[model samples]
Target: MKAVYINELGGTDVLTHGDRPEPEISPGEVLLRVHASALNHLDLNLRASNCRRFPHILGCDLAGEVVQISPDAGTDLKVGDRVLVDNRVKCGGINLCEHCASGNDQWCARQQRIGVDRDGGHADYVVAPAINAYTIPDAMPFTEAAALPIAAHTAWHCLITQAQLQPWDDVLVQAAGSGVGSMGIQIAKMMGCRVITTAGSDWKLDEAKKLGADAVINYRETASISQAVREMTDGKGVDVVFDCVGADVWEENMLCLKPQGRLVITGVTSGSRSSIDLSILQGRPLHLIGSGGRSRRSMADVMKMVNQGALHGIVGRTFPMAGVAEAHQAMHDRDFFGKLVIEH
Candidate 1:
């Protein structure tokens, strides 16, 4: 099978597009004929970070067809089933552990990310646990289905599960051009929230407004985003702030939140190190929550909405599987909005 893999950790220079052996399925696993895979910032980090193995395939969001099922796999899925492979890998096998049993597999102590801790879907063929593959509607395109696993699920977990966004609540989403941020804006709007989002360029801000952001802030043009947000909200800050920009926007995020507001953070794309002023927390009584992967149930709920047309796929660009290096470079340069996908 042809695959994009990294033999050593570095930049795009280390990425190799060549043939590799097709992965074989284990008990409770199935072979997936990957049709499309989406790139996330995590792919970049993994490419540069130390890994336990060489020749690692980096991609988590995958849309594929089941080509082979293990005899021991207990599933109704058969060959030719179109499915979206969930990126979160549970600890125990098909027999669920306590965490996975409760739909909290993200917290499973032995859990691993598909692309990060194991070989992922950046190839023509990959293997996944049967339970990790969710069937998609026949009407959905593989490109769009490939875009949903990580960003959409993360946004749903952050805003709905963690932040508890309320209807008509004023919300601020940082980095509106990002996968999660773009999804956050749409989800908040769908939930009846007044969504305000920030981006570096006017073009991205305009695009964000089209994605349902009620107010758009061009951070590059604005000297103080918090002040701008305050002005937009008539002195009362937003009830919730969904920020993944990390240290670069941490202080501003604090300033943009209303008293007792919730701030849900899922990533630190702009460096993680930051200094917090304890006085602001004492004064405002803010809620700071950190989140990561969502549960399978959460992904199902979001997908149901997507299938129903309540939520839309946000695919910004598509690259052939061999052009993954270029896709990685674009993501690193922040040159696109929403998700970047690799078609197999």
Candidate 2:
């Protein structure tokens, strides 16, 4: 099997493309011939982190055709089925993991992530629990399906599940150019919300508008994002703030929200540490949320919407399998507007 893997933790220089041993499926698992894989910020961090096992493959979101399945897989999925993977793998036994028994498998203490904890789909083939594979719509392309699992699922979980976003709400989505951010704009619009999104570049802001953002802000040019947001909302502030960038925009996000607005954070691309004015909380009373573990059920909900054509994956660019290193470099530079995919 051909794969892009790393033997050491450092820069993109560590990524190597070559043949590796093909993974075999275990009981309750399936073998997939990966058609496409999507890149995430996590891939960059994993490449630079020290704790990763040597010869690790990096890709968390993937779409593929099922090639083989264990008889004990207990799934409706069959060979040749086109599917997108949910990367979170939880301990299965109800008696062994209380979280799985309670249907909060996202928090299972024994959970293992595909790319982070084990070899992932940056190869010709990968093995995953059958339960993590969901069939994608027949009309969708593999590259597009590969882009959806992580970004769309995270956005859906943050907005619909954690924040309890309502259709009438005025929403603010930070980092309009990002995978999750772009998806956030679409999901907000699908719910009939008035969306105001921000990005460092003007072109990215334009793309956000095409995704149904009612207004867009160039954060690099804007002297005061909070004031701009207030002006856009008639000085009332937004009813919800969906933020992926951290510390850098924390204070402004607080100011841009209505008195009781919800602020759901799913990532901290910017440095995480920041001091907050405790008095702001005392006076405004906001619902501050952290997107923790995402549930399998939320991934199912996202796929249901995709199957209905209510949402679609945003593919900013596609790289050949051998271009994984170049893709990593592009992702590090934040040069793409949506998900960067590697087609096999």
Candidate 2 lDDT over 211-326, as tens digits, reads 99999899889999999999999899999999999999999999999998999999999989999998899999899998999998898889899999989899999999889989
Model 2 bad stretches (over 4 Å) = 93-95
What TM-score does candidate 2 get on C-alpha atoms? Answer: 0.98
Q: Where in model 1 is the C-alpha error above 4 Å? A: 92-98, 101-103
Colliding pairs, model 2: none
Per-residue lDDT over 31-107 for candidate 1, one digit per residue giving the tens place of the 0 to 100 score:
99999999998888888886667878888889999999999888999899999988887765557778777767767
Looking at candidate 1, what is the lDDT of residue 216? 88
Judged by lDDT against the true structure, how good is candidate 1?
A: 0.89
Model-by-model lDDT, in order?
0.89, 0.92
Clashes within 3 Å, all models in order? 0, 0
Residue pair clashes in candidate 1: none
- The per-prediction CA RMSD against the true structure, in angstroms, equals 1.5, 1.0
